[model samples]
Target chain A: MKVNAKKVLMLTKISKSYQNNLVINNFSLDFNYGDSVGIIGKNGSGKSTILKISCGLLKPDSGNVLLMGKSFDSTEDGLLIKSRMGVVLHEDMLYPQLTVFENLNFYSKILGIKNVNTKIEELSTLLNLSDYLKISVSKLSNGNKKRVSFAKSLLNDPDILFADEPESNLDDNGKEIVSKIFNDRRKRGLTNFFSTHSEIFLEKCSNQLINLKDFENA
Target chain B: MLNWFKVLSILIKKDIKIEFQTKETLVTLCLFGLLIITVFSLSTENNSLINQNFGAGILWSSVIFAGSIAMVKFFYHEEQNKTLQSLLVMPVPSELILFSKSIVFFIFLSISEIIIFLISSVLFNLNIFSLKLILGCIVFNIGYSVVGSFFGVISSKSSSKEILLTMLLIPIITPILMFIIATTNDVIRSELNSNFQTWLGLGISFDIIFLTLMSYLFGKILED
Candidate 1:
């Protein structure tokens, strides 16, 4: 199969399973620059698994994942691809012991962002996390924790963002803020690959939709 | 290379900061180790010869068991909150994650060892301090931390993580445990045992071999 070097993300014949239970089988998709793709499916439809594999968080049993035309086969390539991508999963992935600002600051340094404080400040204000910046994540409510996770994912202004259930546990205003961020990313020609159960969120953020049920048993 | 060091330092600093906030790992390590020492001290109170002959064994058994328990607690938060998944998505090399955790564990282990050793000296009535013993501790700590960190992450995925981590860790680190016990014995006796260098060599070799092998394996394990 000839690879498309211009595509932003590509998954060719991906298959994943847990023990004898298969989740995703021979699944394939292509995402390009400026595309906002949202996947909708039932609770066990492997939406999170697809996003995880696409972001290199989980290895597919049989498949090739190409991000920015580079595969995760080589460590060097994997790092290069990861540097340009961001992910938000069901778990907040923030240290409960660290304050909101500290968590963002730590991740910024890992991403080698030069102006870490400025980036954190901007994100905090945008996500209405400015007031909670000094608060430990463990002390925050579920909605606020979700906002912080969003801010962390956007710290790098990644070329592609992979979010699993990006709006879960969020209030209406919080969902609006996230929808706006996704819309803005699409307008700026960045890519977003996300899974959501809300049709409202899907209409507001995604230009392309994938129903995992259609690919069942394929 | 410079970038790698910068990222490593950031990870290490983050871990240290979290540890300070909770004091969970250090407190667990020190308390558990001290408890073991206290138990042995009470049981062997009547036998000075037992204390003299098996002080090294007693100290290390405490360190090993307590270290395993503490390591389980250390990685539990990473797995529970999915913070490790957060780091895995970043550009940081997986080995750096292993190294950072190992370094942080090494620091905590060293601090706990100091407290445990002091209490053991008073309880066993033996001089537990010497340059040779310190050297042996450093080498042994490196090997233990690296191997423990590797198995710690692996076992954190299991339902019975506490049991699995101890089961996996103790067997892999047997050589280092033996080396440290032998060196501590020589230090206590205040005589250079004929095989002192040989023991030191074994400890050093274990550190180097596992550090290299585990660093490589850590990446593969995380990928799965």
Candidate 2:
């Protein structure tokens, strides 16, 4: 028996306010499968909240979030939807106590991906993290840590990837490697919603960039 | 319910690997442990009844505080270095992250408590290696870490987080520690038989209650 599940994330009039501080004011967005979009917004515009809410991190006071045609319910049934999506927020979400290999091993265990070695090897080579696998993530540079975070986002081979500044603060070579990894991911039918402050990258890889600069292009 | 053990194991293995490297936390923990032991030794004379009564209490208090000194830095280390994003991105429940952190802290507490047990016994010239007391301490330490971890996560974003963690944590943990002290007395002085088990039960219940609640609330705090 074959199971077919449609992947569409819909936010209908999502409004969130934290103690008289309004973050998101009646924002609505839709992401059907095969859509790679970037929301270009300054800090504290609720871009991260939007992604986290969809990922079940925050429950909007008044809104309806639907994942894959299912209500974004807090019930146990929604675990499947959450498991299929990957997210990297602006917050440092990686545990520093874990080494590069241990961190990758953790995702392998979390995702229940059998035979994790091949991808681990591939990601290490592609990201040039091979020498640093045994080193703690805390011992690495910010750029290298970001690379590990990138590799972790792909651990589950997630259908949807919500990345907040995925490739932030990297040199030219790092940017190229990040772009390459993203381009490879794009070919795999990976649905991604990205937010970044790097304008050069925004101009480079944003297939569907939404911003105040060019509504016409959007 | 999720597979919390997977969270627990991954956290332990990963933390142990890192902990072995610099031994930063363990070293500071031992220094703090030694300081507290020395304070107890200087404050009162050996063979004093007060020393015997306060021995287990001081042992655990020092161990818990010392363990928290480093373990409380667990999430903050991740926060500062920006590696926490990788863990948070996994498609697992956010509470698992907090749970895993707490369990690692609990393991550190247990290890420190073992060290305290050895050192205090030597310092006070008394043997505290009884099976019941050790078991009680284990349960008590686990409960303390579960509750302590929530505060640890809460303080990660605060301005004076260490003070905040201690302020909120100590009051809540006082009763748990009381139970532990009472149980230790029961085991050492041989006053009551299975009555000490009540504290163990209470400790386990506290562990379950706080672990579950914190596991749920971690997502909220972790959110922007």
Candidate 3:
């Protein structure tokens, strides 16, 4: 006997462009539970844009994004789907003037997570950021800030995690931690989608590979 | 609804905490306000009637300009680190984000206004110690902060944020400015005239309308 995975996210007939050039044209993909995908492309490719549009950050010129069988049509719809998804874009998205503790604590409160301190401590320890919790984000190194950003995204234990260039500005140990986190989430029947240029990182984290060049150039 | 208030409180608290640490907006607002009050006091020192008649105008004009500076600075951190994107991705509604920013900016503006009020009262011998004046100031701040925060987010995304904020802010807020100036004149004169109630009513109405309108518009503008 074999178990069947349900479709968790679907992007259909998606097309996006900037100025006059087409970035993503008629692009579509269906992701099932426990599926991990890595989008690969050149710098000007629409990999990040695709991730953004799928997560409701950037709207596609013409397409529909369906999450758990619901369409992104209204504010309420977007909010409902977004709450179940976590995103880490290229930017750290942490307040520079605030400490790591403060940043994570604030997000936890907004996420309505109970026992926030315990959650912060657990994630910080896993990311090797236990000692930097009290330091301001501005004073942290790029790798440390990246780790903090990663920790912030996992605070809610999202079912779907979308990361744009997840391995950027990270040391080998940091990358290993991120890869391990991805594997852990996948083992728990969650889904992960990320865009990266590193083949090795993609192999370690993603089970499905999407070369965005094939979509954009075709 | 309960969750909305909780998220609103968290957003406001986060902004206040960051501001307390950096003090960038506070310093700019206070220093700019002080400079305006100083310039006006010196310019009107020799003229008794002008000082008495136009002192309220001078004080409010200073606040309007200085408060805009603070509003722009308030959104600077969010743009710098892309924290606005973080907030938008949360479970919270976009309208609540605008409301929180407006509330935080209002508190900051009110604090600076108190300092401006004290300094102007001493320098220009202004008798601006009336209950109606206090209430009017609250109404004026509400209108300014709501509209200013809305435009501030837009301008902060532009290449020329400071100029863009002023250009978008001043014209839209003209009616509110007139209402405040009229109410301030009555306070400065220490006499409630026939038009005092009318101006105060206008100011309150402006606050209500813009606050509601801006809160709705903020969600739409931010989503785009």
Each prediction's TM-score versus the true structure:
0.97, 0.84, 0.96
User: Deviation in angstroms for B201 in model 1?
Assistant: 0.8
Q: Model 2 clash pairs? A: A92-B84, A92-B85, A93-B84, A93-B85, A94-B83, A94-B84, A94-B85, A94-B86
Worst 10 residues of 2 chain B by lDDT: B82-91
**Per-candidate DockQ versus the true complex?**
0.74, 0.40, 0.66
lDDT, model 1: 0.93
Question: Model 3's CAPRI class?
Answer: medium
User: In model 1, how well does chain A match by TM-score?
Assistant: 0.97
RMSD for all candidates, in order, please. 2.0, 3.8, 2.3
Task: Point out the higher-scoring one by DockQ: 2 or 3.
Answer: 3
Q: DockQ for the candidate 1 complex?
A: 0.74
Name the regions of candidate 1 deviating beyond 4 angstroms. A1-4
The better candidate by lDDT, 1 or 3, is 1
* Candidate 3 TM-score versus the reference: 0.96
Candidate 2 lDDT, B1-224, residue by residue in tens = 23767655766677667678657777777778878987988786786587778877777678767766775566566657555555544545667667676667777777776777678777887666787787777777777777777777778777787778878888887767877888766655667455666777787787778777877777766654
Ranking by DockQ: 1, 3, 2
Model 3, residue pairs in steric clash: none
